[model samples]
Target: MKIAELLRSAALVTAVAMIPATTATFAQVDGRAGPEFAKLFATYQRIKASYVEPVEDEKLIRGAIDGMLAALDPHSAYLDGSDLQRLETMIDGNYSGLGLSVVMEDGAVKVISPFRGSPADEVGIKAGDYITHLDGELIYGGDLDEAVQRMRGIAGTSIRLTIFRPGRDEPFDVSVTRGVIELEPVTFEVQAGNIGVITVNEFSRDVGQDVFRAWQGIQREAAGRVNGLVLDLRSNPGGSLDEAVELSDLFLSDGAIVSQRGRARGESLLYEAESVYRGEIADDIPMIVLIDAGSASASEIVAGALQDHRRAVVMGERSFGKGSVQSLLPLGRDAALKLTTARYYTPSGKSVQEGGIKPDIAVPQLSDPDWEKRRKYQLRESDLRNKLINEAGLKDEELVEDNLADPRFKLTADELKEQGVEDFQLHYALETLRRTTPSAVALRR
Candidate 1:
């Protein structure tokens, strides 16, 4: 592929923590690095010559590369062979698997989030749950890629996953039937009171256009003026950066959308409004953005932009707070480095590195039976190992807002279920919008 197209391809998946990338020729190595290189070569030679078992050069080299990247950050990695193919398959958005976004955490595979309506989501596999075994076979301390490969199979296949939920007393097993995961990036529905609810599952290719079309569809379906809108991004492990910008631009007519700063030349960039869509699709409608611990990367970009612009009322919990950008620097024909290149910021110049986008109104999912338990173990960017620190520095009080008791959120899961409320956060947002006047939406600015 051409270099530009290759760069664009990198931003296509974020659930697995891939982001946008640009290729660049390697610069000449510094002469002072000769001694370090000599040490590395000496170690390689010693391993090949003195190790008890005959180790392949390819295995050693790959191990060295993996070790080097692992030291940098959780996101950076060496991609080749199966890894490269998996990325390509993700970009295509069709695979026979139990659809999930997961990350390796301290030798265990922890779910970032299950894709909406996927087999895993259907089977009640939730974010923050750790998979200890697959088909009753211990998988802890194993390779994440291998575990993921085992979970994916023919559509009719079923996999038994042993889950260790943080608040649960014991590990439980779940049988998930693998199916063709065809990601529907965007979906829209018109609710009562002519309100539109648009759920962005991920920021995959053409998501901006998809959202624009969704608004158009909602308008047609409503058959009248839309009163309010809900942009549901809960558990949306983010995707493409460009699509994030495009989606943000759909709601923002003017102002700085997002910016990235890096040490390398040409790495820094500033994206503004009117670059993708000319004007807001629903400029006058009251809007609310729903986020949670699973909303990350590109998801943060959109939330931060709209919140900074005061165009939407951001509700729910703080986001996953992944503000850094990654680049897929090609090493050879098959190998590439997914390296963290730059840190992005909101229009208000807030870096969402460790301190993710805090909601304007903190609304907990009271309908979740394990809401309190899960909150105690909720994971965010700050929870990740070796995460980039927010230069602004997060205060203790800021990150610890959940500890306060709120009498308003006392409804139990059973109580809410009896009241016919499946999702408390969405219900809250919809009710907020339904009751909000146009003047009230404007007053948020």
Candidate 2:
């Protein structure tokens, strides 16, 4: 991400109680230092007076504001008024732009996930797709936020995209009309042979409601008969922390869901699943949650919480270790600051900071075409970072196995023959849940 782009979301702290009560909504920031209002004005004058050339005071002041707020944390941020309003709208999972979740992977805005029913998703954008251009202008090697802002416009507006995908020669282009992105969090369907497959891609404000609706649909389709639920959390980078807790509450009871700790706050926040909404699934039904490295943040929150509470058997490798919580602080002019405030804990008082949550059964992902042995190249994290930085482009075939950090093991598909997990850890979880549930029922009786 470009510095300028991040500064676009800069935020300031709350004033002292003595300060005039403006908006009555400033986040409760611990204020010790008196107002910098005078110092701020002096700094502005200093910049205006001492420069060799008359620098744009407005731009420099904005940068200073961004710098001031960013020092707080990664999540507290200033928002340009428009950006602020958009941020509010985003909480509901709907935005009037190309529906794409992107990040700066290797100096370029790489597409992580595309929301279904959004223009980006409908245009066949997949996870890991690197977007190189918008409207024929090369956006690579520049501020990622600037590139993103260029990609958004009013709903029904047409925008162009240049993407690089694996096994493709040259970048491709797609023109899509931006539409209202209505995020559908959960969707389920009975797979062949009666496997209940549920896809939970991301969490938003609507996740709890969406999940409840999906559960109802699954039950209705089962027609008074229900099999085990395969709750898919693959490629889910996660969203709201509260929503993750709410989603976990759907299944768990009498166990912690997640916890948080900071400098002043040290007591463990145990989240027991209240019998808030009794459903037919309850504890008797066998359940499994599929996760991967892409399943991070709030996604890990849900998976870890459920697994700890013995609600769902988790499959796949260790989750993406992102247990830190970020608070979005509102900066002036619509930008905001995203500050990392505290480390969140699973209901069991565990933190997945350096070590991700270990699955009961690990299933490393193995795609065909073994490349590790062919290359025999041992690459460290720094090597990959350097590759992306120097290349300034998206190279897909270069994506080696993403499951190397698995809690169980990280191996590709062909490797499964000698050291294989063909069913992956997920299959093992299903079988285990199947056998354990019935036997547990027998014992309970």
The candidate scoring highest on TM-score is 1
lDDT of 1 by residue, 221-262 (tens): 988589899999988878777889889999988999999887
Model 2 lDDT tens row, 376-431: 33222223321112122323333333545544445556666565444455555555
For every model shown, what is its TM-score relative to the native structure?
0.95, 0.69
lDDT (C-alpha, whole model) for all candidates:
0.85, 0.62
Candidate 1: regions farther than 4 A off: 1-8, 15-25, 395-398, 442-444
- Which candidate's lDDT is highest? 1
Model 2 lDDT at residue 417: 58
The true-versus-predicted C-alpha distance at residue 320 of model 2, in Å, is 2.3
Model 1 pairs in collision:
none
Q: What is the number of backbone collisions in each predicted candidate, taken in the order shown?
A: 0, 38
Tell me the spans in candidate 2 whose CA falls farther than 4 Å from its real position: 1-47, 50-53, 68-76, 104-107, 122-124, 141-146, 153-160, 164-180, 265-268, 275-280, 329-337, 364-437, 440-445
